[model samples]
Target: MVGGMHQRKAEMARHSDCFIALPGGYGTLEELLEVITWAQLGIHEKPVGLLNVDGYYNYLLTFIDKAVDDGFIRPSQRHIFVSAPNAKELVQKLEEYVPVQDGGVAKLNWTVEIEQPPPPPTPASKQVGFPALKKAEIAL
Candidate 1:
């Protein structure tokens, strides 16, 4: 049966052996990130990998690199997510993951929220309308 994020956390805490994150949505990202956080904090030591089917995770890999560059995440921490465009290499990385000290994580008081740009404002009152087609110029 499907469960909530909390339940999934408990499940992961129970496993603590291996995890494979395939192409997924928000929930997948959340679960993988949490496990990586636990590993960073030394709470758990496990392997995490991304099966980047059809370049699904290319953008995500770039974002993680940006995270490292922006100092929001560490370069070593980038090891937490192994990216492979195919299952073979992905599984291999997961099999070979070796957990080492991630140093420290500064606790930044922050709130997590998904941001989406607002829609553009509408014109005053549809003032700009399509040109009226002339009956004489119309072709069947």
Candidate 2:
């Protein structure tokens, strides 16, 4: 087994060219989400897929659709991952995926302008109370 959970995930992500999620519980879901987030952030160009055997992921798919409808997820961003009913189809979809060129243009900028507040004045070193400790005094 890998030495640590994060180390395992990093190593997996580094070595993987694609990510697929089979029917599973929380760990599986978490891994799927992490890979998808990495793709969204341009950390990697790997394809992410879901194998929806026996309609196992139907509810999750519906939830994703709801998210898109609710505007929490952009419609273009929905193409970041693919889903299919079986292994063969899912794999085929992954094999055919082409990464989006520029995270897709945002449908709306959604910027809000508010009255500006002035920055807080910086406190002097003397006002901080304690003196800086030696490097050795700090524990890891």
Each model's TM-score? 0.66, 0.70
Local distance difference test, candidate 1: 0.73
| Candidate topping TM-score | 2
Give candidate 1's error at residue 98 in angstroms. Answer: 1.1
Where does candidate 2 have its weakest 10-residue lDDT segment? 106-115
- Candidate 2 lDDT by residue in tens digits, 14-132: 78889999999999999998887777766677899999999999999999899999999888777889999988899899999997656454332213334355577776733753445
Alpha-carbon deviation at 63 in model 1, angstroms: 0.6
lDDT of 1 at 61: 88
Best-matching candidate per lDDT:
2
Q: List RMSD in Å for every model shown.
A: 10.2, 13.2
lDDT of each: 0.73, 0.79
Q: After superposition, how far is residue 3 of candidate 1 from its true place, in Å?
A: 9.0
Off by over 4 Å in 1: 1-4, 105-140
